[model samples]
Target: MLFVGGITLLKNFERLMEAFARVHERQAIPLVVVGFNRWRFENDLAFAKSHRASAHILFPSFVADEAMPQVYRMASCLFFPSIYEGFGIPVPEAFATGCPVVTTNRGCTSEVAGGAAHLVDPFDVEDMAQGLELVLSDQAYCQELIARGRARPPTSASTAAPVNPWIYSSKYFTKLPNRRGPRASLAAPWGISREPLRQCQTYQGTNYMLPPGGVMVDSPDRGRYI
Candidate 1:
């Protein structure tokens, strides 16, 4: 079974669907797409129907928190290739549920997977398909992933929440006495090398980072950290 969360473009739904079209030809692996985003789901379903792959795709809308484990239990693997993410909670969650994951190296998925899951390119359909095939074809590889996943360390309490602007800002920045101003520290994620960050002010009392290459921040509500 292949499990994906949403139909959003960034989640790489279309590409996963394409890969499944190829995967189904090799073996009829069932796809379970869990989400409640109406417009996006409709769009992705339309694409699947057009490709004649809808028969193999199952849409289960708005799965509750308690039932999520059972959902994970039903799957042989979790397939997530998000182009970006605040952090991939599902990666660790899947690990906890004893489900091996095939995810992208994009965003924080790799960080969260910690080498437990198969990492693939989110952009290329064939690469994604190959990864799927590899994990499914090799019991040794799948067991390695599951064993490593079980042994993988839990993410930090801060990481329990999605990696957000607040992840970089709230934890790293300190406010001066009498609200003199907000100052961001050079601190990076734990065990990471710290770099120098110039002083900057907060937006609406919320600290954010504007890095050298580009200004980026994660919205806790939106789930994208950019």
Candidate 2:
């Protein structure tokens, strides 16, 4: 039995149902959709009625995490072509369970898969078909990935950098302001640019001189140039 699991969005659920219909034509594989919504299946009544193998489509609302290993063992591959994601966790989990993964190459999915899974453009149906084909038809490639996946060690946490809790705390996370506005003027004393002015005064009644440190600091308090 082939298993499809994820948040049951209407569009994705419909595609999964249709794809199963098409694939069942070539091979009589039963599809058990775990975590799918019953409302979605009911709403697509007409489409479901016209499906080639409606009986083969099983909708199980929720499956526990502990049972997922058994689910992966029961399937040939996991077909997950989500439209978008920030960081896909399911791909890694599927790979770790010794299941071949075929998913979209959107967002950080490519980085996560790391050539361990078959990738395809989410928007291209042909690409999705090709991805499915590569996994299904190419036995040697599929076996190679399964081996790599089994041997692949778990990844390290991205937020493992050493942070100074005393210097910067969680409170600073919410208080950051957007820097799109004009930059504030520097608060240091203005230095003489053209020539070194030990003590020179301009019409504005300010002094421009090279400081002891030879560093120039722009200042708004002193008006005249010296």
Most lDDT-accurate candidate = 1
Task: Residues 1-226, candidate 1: write the lDDT tens digits.
Answer: 6565666877888888888888889978888887656457777777877876789888766677667777887788899989997666677778877888999988888888899999999999999989999998999999899999878756542323323221222533334555533333322343211122222323223344444443445421221223
Question: Model 1 scores what on Cα lDDT?
Answer: 0.69
Task: Give the clash count for each candidate.
Answer: 1, 11
lDDT: worst 10-residue window of model 1? 190-199
TM-score of each candidate? 0.69, 0.58
Clashes (candidate 2): 11
Per residue, candidate 2 scores C-alpha lDDT tens digits across 1-226 of 3545443452365665665566667767777666544456555645665677788776665787667777877777877776665455566666767888887777666777777888877666666766676777789988987877666544421111111112123332332344332323222233322222321212122333334345443432443333
Q: lDDT of each model, Cα atoms only?
A: 0.69, 0.57
Query: Which residue pairs show collisions in model 1?
Result: 218-225
Q: What's model 2's lDDT at 98?
A: 83
